[model samples]
Each structure stands twice: as C-alpha cells, then as structure tokens.
Target: MTTLKEPVLTKRIPTHPWGDPTDRKVVSYKQYVKTDGYKGLKNALAMEPSDVVDLVKAAEVRGRGGAGFPAGMKWSFLPPEDGGRRYLAINSDESEPGTFKDRLLIDFDPHIIIEGIAICMHACRLDTAYFYIRGEYHHQREVFEAAIKEAYENKIFGKGSKLGQINGRDPDLFLHRGAGAYVCGEETALLESLEGKRGWPRIKPPFPAVAGAFGRPTIINNVETLAICTPILERGEDGPKWFQSMGTQRPEGAPPHVPASFGPKLFGVSGHVNRPGVYEEELGITLKDLIEGLCQGMLNGKKYKSAIPGGISTGVLGPDEYDVRLDFDITKYDTLGLGTAGVIVMDEDTCMVGVARNIAHFFGHESCGQCTPCREGTNWMSKMLSRIEAGDGTTRDLDLLLEIAGSMGALPSGRGATICGLADGANWAVRTIVNKFWDEFEAKVSKQRFVSLSVVGS
Candidate 1:
C-alpha cells in the first residue's frame, strides 16, 4: 500500500471520556459523577428543547454507524410532538463483520451511553427510549444493566429524579435484548423486532423518522453515535468545532456545506496484521498509517495483498489504493466504500477466492430473504464461489460470478434492488475480489485444467 505525506498530528484529545488506561473497572456512579458524567444531561435539561436540537445541529455530529447520516438532522426529522409517544432507539446490535467498537463502549463506558440517551431525549422531546442490545452480548448487557440500575438508584431516573425530568416530563429508558440476527442492525428492522414482529426491513416512504416503533415518530442511533453525545454536550459549541477540525477537509466540488467525516473514529482492525485489535484514530487517517503505524504492519512481516476498509459489506481496496483517505465522502467515488470503519487486512499469502467465498457465505446465510435479488443472489453467488475455491469451477464461472454480483445491485446499479444493504455487501465482496485479483482466480482455474489434462494422458 502507498503511504501519504503525514499530516501534522494535532494534540490528541481524549475521545473515550470514560476510558481509563490505568484501570479497566467499569465507571461507578460516584466515580462518574466526580468526572462530570451527567454534566451534558444537566446542560441539556437547562436548554430549551429546540435549542438543544440546534446545538447538536451546529455541532454537526454524524451517525457513527456505517451510514454516516448526520445525527442532528435525523433528530430534526421527527414530526412535531403530538402529545403522544416518541422514541429514541439506540442500536447496540453490532453485528457487522469485523466490527466490535460498540461492544467495547457498552462494556467499559455504559454510563456515557446512558447520559447521551438522556441528552438526546431532551433534544427530541422524547420521554421514552430503548437500548436494543444484541442477545450475544450477554456480558455487555450485564454491564449496561448494572449501570442502568445504578443510575436509577442514584435518582438519575424514576419519579422525582432531576435527570429523569427533562422538558417537564420524566423520561423512561428500557434495555431491550435482540435475538442474534444481522438484519436487526438496520433501524427499521430493529423497530419491527422491538414491536414483537419478525426482523424484516420496512420499505422507505414513511421512514422511521415519520413512523417508527409501534407506529409512532422515532429516532434511532447506533451505540457510538449516542455515546458521542456526552462529549459534544459537555463541550457545547466547541465540541463540533473540535470534531470538525480532526478530519480531512471535504474535497472541493463536493456539496458546498457538507461536513467532512470529522471526529475520532474507532477502527476495528483485524486479520493478518501485527496487532489485530481496535485502535482509535482521527478520521481520514490513511490506510498506510493505520496498518504501518498503529498495527505495526502485516503479521510476520508479510507484504500486503488487499483490505476491506469498512465491514465485509464494503468493497476491497488493493495495496495501490491505500493512499486514499479513509473518509466517507472520498470513499464514495470509484469502487471504494467506508462502512463501519472495520479494517480487515489480507496478506500476500491469503487466498482472495477463499476470502470472497467466505464473505459471500456469510451474507447468504444472514439474508432476511425478503428481497428476491438478495435472497437468491447471495446463495447462488456463495455456491459458485465455493465451487471455484474447491477447484470444481469452469472457465465460465469467473464471468458468471461477476454477472451475478452486478445483478445483485453492486455499484452503478445503486442501492435500489435489495430491501437493505446486505445484498450490496455480498455483491461488493465478490465483485472487488474478482476484479482486483483476477490473476489469482484465473491461476487456480488454469492449474485445475492442467491437472485434468495430465490425468487424461495417464
């Protein structure tokens, strides 16, 4: 991978507020109070509800989930409060392959998420919120549940609690567990699951903003997005500026006022790297820096092959493309994508065909089976890739794989075919691997054919 000229590293501001390097214990309520844990909540409660919304908008906080939607804009989309129920659903279902930042946040800093929920509830005039955690995260769920208990016990919630009463109403927060399904990570699908229905994504028009969670107006955010609220509220206007300053500037000719993919990002780096773990870094840090600088380069000193910059759903970037900035806007061009910032690296010795097959298998199994293109495409592609990997593929299989991937709504076709992004993800993995590593796939086929000819002569 090519390296870029290093930008001057700015003073590293603490992004993980509740994280203590010296100790790994969960932050107790008393310890949290000492560090001004609820300061954002207190400040939010003092502000007019609309002003709180404006404050978040001015800060320009983008959703930390793969979509990168603006947090404040999503809140503003809610219909005017009608003296009825509105909801804030925090998506803790971190099921994206190669992603684990949310799990860490919930385990180490549960109180931060809670405080963020309180602040957002005040901003949106929401009196009820749900913390939808994945069922597999039993330990994280216990940590968060204990924190919730502590908050309520300390009068942070319940009747007559100052933190409970925001905007003249006592807000209620519920921690709901999700059955382990990748589809529930989608906000609308999550609502369906929350409402006691099967976890299938709803079609657009009346987006979750207009009607969600039992047919009421709703706003949903990922765990990291909500956790970020604490720091943003704590610093007020300065928070957004600090965040905006951290990332690379938006390229010219882009939308005139679109914010850069600003703020600190937790990159869940895995696969063939010296340090296969999550590392927090400023957004727009080059792939070269992330791998060479943070991860100490490829494991056992192996040369780089390719990488999946986001989760498995994003297309692969070869070593040559590593110079590209890891920003959402920049990645939108070409075959590149920045989904969830989960960097899965591959070394020179890795088999691209096997990798593609594995990713295809995952999406195939995880598909909700609602959309025809995704439901059928993923399974077909997986089967074909497996055949290719196992030396049973004909020469025609390569083109067939490409054809199936494009039909499944890979880029240029855009996101219209599938009910959700899962299909696109499967397409991306196959398309990129075949296109970028054609030599490897072709070599496998040629070797198999040569072996067959030798056997026939014998």
Candidate 2:
C-alpha cells in the first residue's frame, strides 16, 4: 500500500486559513493585533500607495469573487487625498450555495482578514473598514465581532493606529451584520444594507469605486482577498517571488488578458465526495484531482455524473469536463462561470433536472424582487423546473425552458423582463438541465405518464 499527502494550493494557504504555526490563533482581536497582526499596514504605510498597488499587481492578487478582477487596479480606482471617509468593506456574506470557504477565514483567523483590510485601507488612503458578515453565520459573526472589539480596545484599529496619518487623520472601522439576504452578497447591495437601507443593487456609473457606502469611494473584497494580504505583506519581495512558482505558466501571446501564473483558490468540496471538506489548491487544479485526491474519491461506490463548479450560479459541467483545468478561462464553457470556487459533485443517482430546480428555487426565493425580470423570471423558471422534476413536463416543456433561459440570460436591454444575477442564476439552472440531461428528462416524463395510465387502468 502507498500513502501520499494532499497537494498544497499555494504558499499563502497555510498562513491565511490554516493558521501560522509561529503565530497565535485569533483567540481575541487584541491577541491578534498584539501578536503582530497589522504587518500589512506597517509595510504599506512606509510605501507610496502606487508602490503598494504595484506590489499587489506584481503579486497578481485578483478578486476572489468569481469575476477575478485585478485587485490592484480596483484599489487604484480610489481618489488620491482623503477622499472623505473612503471605505474598505469586506464582503463576508458567504451565502453562495456550495461556497463555505470564507466562513473558515472569519471564524479561524479573523486577524489575518483584519490585517488585510487595513492594508487595503493603506493602499486606498482610506482609514475606515467594514466587515459585512452574513447574518446566519452566527459563529463567524460572534467570532469576528469579538475580534473587532478587541482590536479597537487594544488600539490596533481606529483613532490611534498607524493608519491615522494617511492624510494626517485617523479613520474608524465598522463591523456590520447583514440579515441573510443572498443578494446582499453583491457588493453594492451589501453597502446598501450597511447603510441601514433595504439591500438592493445600485447601478454602476458611480461604480462603488466612485460613490459607495454613504457616497464615499469604496473597495469591497471577499474574505480570502483580505486574508491573503497578511502573507503578502509578511513575505514582502519574496512573497510575489513565491507566487510565480506555482501552476501552469502563461506564455506571452497565448492570451493577452490571462495572467502568466496561477494562484490559490480555496474550494469547499461537498456532496457525493468521500472526504467532503474544504481544500485549498492551485487555480488550475483538475476537477478529477479535486474529487479523487483531495475529496478522497466518491461515496458508496457511486459513479460521478456532473458538478456545479464555483457555486449554484456557476453552470453545470458533465463528467467529461471534469478533467478540464479549473481556471478563469472558463469563458469557453456553456454552463460554467468562475463563481465562488465551490465544487459540488453529484453521482448518477442525482437528477440533473432536480438539481437544477433546487438551485433555481434558491435563487428565486433569494431574489430581492427589486427588478421585474429577475423577480418574476426566477419564479417562473423555478416553477417550470419543479414541474419537470416532478415528471409533469412535456417534450415541448424543454423548448419552453430553453426560451425562458435565453431571455433571462441575455435579455434585450429594457425590452425583455430580466436583469441581474437572480435572473442569470435561474437561467443557468434551466440551461444546464436542458443541455446536460435532455435524455433523463424525456425518459422520466414519459415513464411517469405511462405509469399514471397503467395505474388508472389497473
């Protein structure tokens, strides 16, 4: 028999989520800061914002959210000078179905995230920071609140910290708890919630970069984004040097937009997998490796069928695509998107249609109902998916689903009744069912009808 250790994602993983052996756990926020938490800030405060931004750019710290937007450029969007109470809001609302990675960061090492947020504040010349954690993550909420209070009491944050002199003044930090709305996971809506208003998506002209969190420039980041900042600061020049050493390298002219090196993506792999735990690995780690190696293979000897990469919003991929490298180049896949980096597996017993319906129903229920298309389209999609899954659908129902998904996914501007991700999520469910399990759907519906008639005759 042979034994092997699971692979490491990137150098930053252990320092961020796994906790540093040399450092203390986030027992208290005061403990975290007293234990040298704000190193990122200390490092950045000595450097110019542009210099700090350049280091982040060199390190390739992209958005942890599905979009993978370049973090340095986003920070550069902040106006120079005081910018009047500019804010750094951490998007700790980790409600995306199948995504549970952020919960660990919040609960396990709150200081790393706090330190990261402070570094971001330095980069943007802003002092105020907000950790907009999810309401239902009560454990994390409690943990983070304690850490924030401790940080405040110890003077690691606000009023007297090193950040106070960014423009010759100190700024405060705000820790807000969001009432569990999935839409609040969106940055602008999260800001709205923080402002004591209904969580609704705001238009981007005034992108959050321009006007946000009570009309001040804002930069919202995911938990992992902030957590990684601690290590990035600790390693200094060696930090980026270490990052370039992992995953597949991008040769010049291969793709103009793709970054040259792969980085870490923390994934929470659940459902049907044998291990069923969160694992951090390189960006381009194959799904097969994720399932067999990290997840310890499938459960109950069941054969794998499909997966929802990232989260529920990410489109479904059949078993064949499992070997495809999981990276940002997912633009080619029909039903896949670079979502929350959550891997949810399903075996053959898993009805793709049922799975689609379950995900669609969640999005429909979570829709804020502010937009007509998203509010109504998600409901219709969920209802139709439910009918199909219950074996009450016709062959024409498949066409109806396709039409509905098309309108929701790429609705004509202002003409069709669809807008934002709620509609897109609904559309993803409908599209995945139609494309991936057309045969299963057709068989189930016809079998149900035949069984119904036979029962009637008997």
**Strongest candidate by TM-score:** 1
Using all chains and alpha carbons, the TM-scores for the candidates as numbered come to 0.91, 0.88
Error of 1 at 295 (Å): 1.5
How far in Å is the alpha carbon of 331 misplaced in model 1? 1.9
User: In candidate 2, which residue ranges exceed 4 Å CA deviation?
Assistant: 1-37, 250-254, 409-419, 447-458
lDDT of 1 by residue, 241-302 (tens): 86666766667777856766777777888999987766677778888888898788889999
| lDDT, candidate 2, 230-337, per-residue tens | 667766777666665554566446766676535666778889988776677777777888888867788988989998788887778876787866776664566546
Evaluated at residue 88, the lDDT of candidate 2 is 85
Candidate 2 steric clashes: 3
- Kindly provide the TM-score of model 1 when superposed on the true structure, using C-alpha atoms: 0.91
Q: 383, model 1: CA deviation in Å?
A: 0.5
